[model samples]
Target: MEIIFLDQNKWIELAQVHSGRIKGGPIAQLFPRLVAAVREGRVLFPLSVANIMETAKRNDDVSRRLIAETQAMLSLGYVHRSRAARIEVELRAAIQRRFGIEPERMPTHWAIAPGFMQAFEPMDELMASPGELARVRRMTSLVDPAALYLNYMVTQDDTRRREANAKLSEGLSALVAQIEGRRARFASESLDMRRRIYAAQSWVDHLDVLNRIVAALGYSFDDLSALGDSTMRALLEDVPTMNVEVEMATRLEAKTGTLSANDVLDMQSFYTAIPYSDRVIAEKAAISHAQQAKLDSKYGVILSRSLEDLSGHYVS
Candidate 1:
């Protein structure tokens, strides 16, 4: 199946089409065929953490509900796993292969779990008898993605979502904040040099995660540390998400881009989607940054801003 990732804006447009708010535009023309593709399993549009969290910030209940329902239909409960989760898998695979050890296989469910999990770790199912548990599972195997989305997207009475969003936003800010603060120090550095410098720093920042996986493999972080600089550079490139993260981060810093929370979310979206999706429709600024970074060619994803780019999808 062709995996497609839509930015939250594109999703809103598609949602407008789905709601008949848009009747004769490029998105409207593309809608029916896209639905057919979904039913036939010829294509899929996966949700990302950015998409979910951004939608929750919307206060328009009607628009939020429409987008939620539209994404539910297209995504069918498939979201890219959390960035924390995905990089671990990537780190494990690369480390195991570097050591000539056969890699451990994780279930595909690890990559694709119920969307209600909201792109976090899989929640454990409640305890129950085997027969009854299986029966309930089968029934809710058709989980309500619409309801799942509405639960978070359409809340006015609760401080829980506001607190959750604040915490999640804060978690993403540290790396960007650290990198951005050092901008003046590196302003004179060449782009490639800066990218490499930041890449190494990014890896070091994430060493705690790598160390956990290293311990599990009966190895220590020093074994990974012992690799020559050239080999380490190659290993960094082998991990797609980090490569994009470093490249985009460097590009933004190069252009003296203003930092914002949305910038962090954009990074999250690109690092997850550009590496994994066949096509990515994101904000123009994002597509521009990725294109300038040459990420589109690197990942072989069609990075576009216009829904008309999808017009050719089902055409033969």
Candidate 2:
């Protein structure tokens, strides 16, 4: 759609009227007539036209009077609410792209420059000067006359608008590249951590096997410090098949009222094997620690390790 740029002086006039200095019936009566001229396409300048109409609507005394004047000026033809609405939609999308969020959704008042940035690329220097551009970026609400005037000013300069558009395009591209890089890094780290977790799991399973052997033997490990290192290695090697033999020996010993060599082996295995619960708790703590490390790396803040510590306590 073709857009007519408004003159800067017209904007200044609208701004003055908005400031409430132009008082009384004559100015109020002239307001509606001026609006009708633009609405009828007799006068053109998109920004000025919108501003004049908006200003009139805001002034209660002027607005009611203009309604009568506007009705008398023409047949009241179809108002271009849809066109205005479309502009508003485009403006909002542009603002979102520039700010990385929807302008209307922001906590602060919005302005036209940010909306323009979303709509067009900004000049490199202008883009770099966030403080200056911020004045324009926060034009979310149309209620502010300053925001409306800024929008009018931006529309008047094709060169500035083009520069702004280019800057925004460059900024968005850079932002996307940065996000993708971070995502790739995270995925790589996650896979590596998964491998470590599996290795830890294997260690735990081995520990559980040793515990089962010890339980079957029904031997106390309290006095195992006397056993030689070679004897301990032999007990560890026999953990897999020791359960049934250990149980049988325990029964035989109960019947005969005497402990055997096989039962002693079982007791040794039990002492060396890690408990399944202990393994699980350790694995969980490791995962929790890894997660906190990742978060700290990403956000530059250390998260509480309390949850991981708590999980370990429960599992152990």
Candidate 3:
């Protein structure tokens, strides 16, 4: 099935429409068709952890309720499948081999929400289980350490304005708080270190994802190293997060860009979407960045700003 990665803004738009806050709006009219596409299995809207947390931050009950309703309608979009524990270890190792990431650093398992293992029955059965629901809730997060590190390096060389940098600082703060909380839990009387382990290991999985992208493009590390930075970025590698950063650098050098934290976060989300998603609906700026990076030509990801536009393009 074609995976549809909806941007947070589109979700909010849908929620606003579905909640009747934006009555008779053109965007609102598109919701039913989008839902039909999902229900028919013509497309899948997988809510990224980022998508969930952003939705959760809504202040109004109407919006939150709409989010819940939308999630339920899109339940079949959850794509994670459980493999044998031994197979998982082998997969991680194989991914490490292709990516050149150290085996020690690779996560032994995909990061799971608390008690996800206990809920690992068949997908259909697990979907109704409290454990599965909890796992989905736990997976909601916004921290992207790999992207943050690259942003830090890029900011150092570009013009770093405190106003423009504040968002980046806030994101970093959130990431730190998450890690500290995990550390505290792991150090306490509780011996359950799964959360701590998963948190650290997930980043390695992110790297492995980049490796797969590079391999699919038929580029070796040496080939990537020698390519123009602009060319290398088209692959959407997050640890290096070269695509958006390169754009940021160009804009900064040309005195045309003000790097905001939201831009960085959006870029991270877009990058994360490409590997698993067949299409990505995101903010116009993020889509433009990806287009400039040649994402469409390289990875065949359909990047669009409107859910309606994407639906019409793919579902007709």
Candidate 4:
């Protein structure tokens, strides 16, 4: 079955509509089609650890049912330790090629113990010195920041957890404000036109580099974008995978700016989908990050916001 990964917002939209919190909107129309598609085995809606955490944040019955329903329909998948190691290796090469920044030594995947596997946190440059940032950068690139942060918070000494939490909170606040500010600006009719023009230009510049990298990886540019579920899965199985999300966050750090804890977690959700799903259905911010990283084209995955768009694109 074709895999379709939904962002947390889409799940919440479906849940709220189901509970009659809102009536007769596009989500109402979209939700049923998604359910039918999943039920008929036309697609697979694989949940991730990120989905579980995001849904668990809300205590309402609607959110509870949504989580349970998703779990029932599909098993939750995570970034396996082995896969993460491969991603880290490729990530280093991509960074060197694209940015000319080379690490002194290859970063090791954070899979020392069973429990440490698949855990990661965003590299908070603000909290580190230049030397420290370089090391932290490699470590963060290998694992999910949310997982790493959470593991650090719970398992570390009290003094360390306190420090990490403080940094996490500060980073999250800054990122949240940044996204909110962007939302407010883009919401304005006067600014919307200029915002779209700027965003379009950013995509054009980023995609050129990304497309070149994918081509260097021996994937045909045209064939890569047109891959179907089975073909895409086979291709990924045959190649080394890079953490496109982290690479995007790293490269676009100057353009897209620093990320918050929530932003990192949101990213981890899409990153998890890279290996486990055929397409990633997400919000503008998430989609933009992937596009900026050129992951959609590079990895041959469909990234779209509209459920209708996906429906038309993924007809079985």
Order of all candidates by lDDT, from best down to worst? Answer: 1, 4, 3, 2
Q: Which candidate number has the best lDDT?
A: 1
Off by over 4 Å in 2: 1-150, 189-316
Query: Which sections of candidate 4 miss by over 4 Å?
Result: 74-241, 256-258, 311-316
Local distance difference test, each candidate: 0.77, 0.32, 0.49, 0.52
Candidate number achieving the greatest TM-score relative to the actual structure: 1
* Predicted candidate 4 versus true structure: per-residue lDDT over 106-208, tens digit per residue: 4332221122223232222322357755876576667554454344323445565456556655766776676556545554444335433334443454465
Over the full model, what C-alpha lDDT does candidate 2 score relative to the true structure?
0.32
Clash list (residue pairs), candidate 3: none
Better of 1 and 4 by lDDT: 1
Q: Which stretches of model 3 miss by more than 4 angstroms? A: 75-170, 173-258, 311-316
Residue 157 in model 4: lDDT: 59
User: What's the residue-level lDDT of 40 in candidate 1?
Assistant: 88
Per-residue lDDT over 170-254 for candidate 2, one digit per residue giving the tens place of the 0 to 100 score: 6545644543443344443443454343334333545543343334344333323235455443442233223222322222222
Q: Which digits, one per residue and each the tens of the lDDT, describe model 3 over residues 210-277? A: 45545665665575556555533323333322333333323222222344445445644664455446
- Rank candidates, TM-score, best first: 1, 3, 4, 2
Name model 1 segments beyond 4 Å from true.
Answer: 105-110, 121-142, 145-147, 150-157, 166-179
What's the CA RMSD for each of the models? Answer: 4.2, 32.7, 15.6, 13.1
